[model samples]
Target: MADTAFHSARQRYADLGVDVDAALSRLAGISISLHCWQGDDVTGFESSSQSLGGGIAVTGSYPGKARNPAELREDLDKALSLIPGSHRLNLHASYGEFGGVKVDRDQIDVSHFAGWIDWARSRRMGLDFNPTFFSHPLAADGFTIAHSDDGIRGFWVRHGQICRKIGAAMGAALGSPTVTNVWIPDGYKDTPVDRLAPRRRLEDSLDRIFAEPLSPAHNLDAVEPKLFGLGSESYVVGSHEFYLGYAIRRGKLMCLDAGHYHPTETIADKLTSVLMSVDRVLLHVSRGVRWDSDHVVTLNEELLAISHELVRNDLLGRVHIGMDYFDASINRVAAWVIGARNVLKSLLIALLEPTERLRQVELNRDLTARLAILEECKSLPWGAVWDEYCRRQSTPVGQSWLDEVRAYEQLVLSKR
Candidate 1:
């Protein structure tokens, strides 16, 4: 019955000039980087008593959270098994294996992440990296790179410099370029008296941090911007404009996080504009609830629009797709599967679009036909094509993946 349904759907799509098979083929080639912090709720193995500061917070005490790297890897393995296609793993600087030793952010080395490199290489997966600038004593006052004190700012600078080298090492070892992103939660609760000084300091800090350039094949540098956070409600130093100019001038990749912008603003609209200035982009796909709540990715209007923008504009190669969310309210592994599958599903729907036909209608200035075709395209058999994709990938078809997660929770996560 499944095969029959898929065949019928394929024919139906073909009638509309949509190639279902081609869409599945393209979707399989694209990889969405899965964030490691989500598995452990941003609580790295570095310290148990470390407080989440610098405008970062993870709510909910969901049981079965991965307490160690081993457990996190175990849970990731299960999540990856359920998710189709090859994907990359995104790791933070704090998640390195320090062997219970006191390794400060500045003191971290590639040696700490050797285990991760080996694990990713063994699985034939690529890796991405981020410098954790939050949740530390140095960052307690809600500043790091842009701190007024040079000593404190320099400390964070060293961390970023070291993280880039570690990212390069991972990429060199895995034969894939690692996008090492820098996102500092440097801001003030109230309106800053002098935002210019901090911005200048940040620019200098970043210049020093990225001075030792590595090959793009080994490490691609990216800077992520946030509008505001918990304590940084009034002013976020690294606003969108700050990084957009920096990226354009420095030739670095700009990371557009979905939840980083205002509720009314969507990253989809900014892709074409940002790409015009920056050479490449790194997307941190997430669903925002009024603010940067970091909710799980859903197949909503924004997600579909983002996916469509990438597909229609032919910017997939120039953009590094990744997911950024931490929903601890539910099963952690299930959250991973849900977000990843939705991301893939969105991409599949985008790829299955009759872009040429739509463009042709728009080129003829037929607004009526363009709107009509877009609405009709939404009702097509995209879900059937997605099920066929899962079947081909040897993954669970539809909600059956949830059953695997429930069973794993009983056998593994429950014990944890």
Candidate 2:
């Protein structure tokens, strides 16, 4: 019955010059990097005494949070099972396996993440990494890499170097390039008189950190910028313009996090602008209610616009999609599954659009028909096609996955 519905819907889209099957196939091939912190409330197992700092905060004290790597991986596996299509794992430096030994952020190496590589290799999943710039004693002052204190700045610089090396090692071990993203919460809570000094320091530190030559096949470097953060509301050192200019000048990938910009500014519009200068781009797909709060992703207008822009520009191959949100308010696994599915669903929706025809209409200056066709597409049977996609992937369709999450919560999460 679902197949019949999908076939009928497919024909409807075909009449509109859209190939539903091709869209599904393209969507399945695109891999989204799932953040590991979502499974454990961003509390990596590095140290229990480590307080969350650096403009980072995880609200809600939901029970059954993963306490160790084993638990976190188990929870992630459950979440991945519910989400259809291939996916990757994104890990922070704090999430490295220490084997009961005290491994500080600066001292972490590839050895600490060897187990993670093995785990990813077993599942045939790629791994992305991030340098932990927040939540450390050194970063408590809301400065890193740009701190006035030379000692503090050097410590973070070393951490970034080590992370790049580790990222390369993971890529070599897994036979897939690892994207090592560098994001620092270096800003001031209040207005600063000497903002130039900090930015200059940051530029120098980044230069030193990325000086090492690494093959792109092994690891690619990306620098992420933020508008503002909890403690850095007054001013953010790594603003969008700073990183945009730096990325273009340095020939590195620029990360545009959805929650990192102003509420009114959507990254969908910046896609073409950035892609014009950079070879590759990274997207941190997230949702922010009113600020840079890392809320779980959903199929909203902004998300759909991002997807549409990517598809409209034919940039699926030029951009790397990664999920970046941590909401401990609900079932953590459910959060992952929900966010991942929504991202894929948004891309599927974009892929199913008749972009070629729409482009031709706009090119021919047929404004009336273009507007009419685009509005008509909103009422298409996209849901039926999405349900078929889930069926084809051997995963639950629609609300059925919610039941699986509840069962997992009761049987697996409840015990934790």
Question: Local distance difference test, per candidate?
Answer: 0.93, 0.92
Where model 1 places Cα greater than 4 Å from the true spot, the runs are none
> Candidate 2 versus the native: TM-score?
0.99
Ten contiguous residues minimizing lDDT sum, candidate 2: 47-56
Task: List model 1 lDDT by residue over 1-416, tens digit each.
Answer: 99999999999989888888888889999999999989988989898776577787888888999988899999999999999999999999999999989999999999999999999999999999999999999999999999999899989999999999999999999999999999999999998899898899999999999999699989999999999988999999999999999999999999999999999999999999999988899999999997665998888999999999999999999999999999888899999999999999999999988999999999999999999999998998889999999999999999999999999999999997
TM-score, each model?
A: 0.99, 0.99
The CA lDDT at 351 in model 2 is: 93
Q: List the residue pairs that clash in candidate 2.
A: none
- Cα RMSD for predicted model 2: 0.8
Against the true structure, candidate 1 reaches a TM-score of 0.99
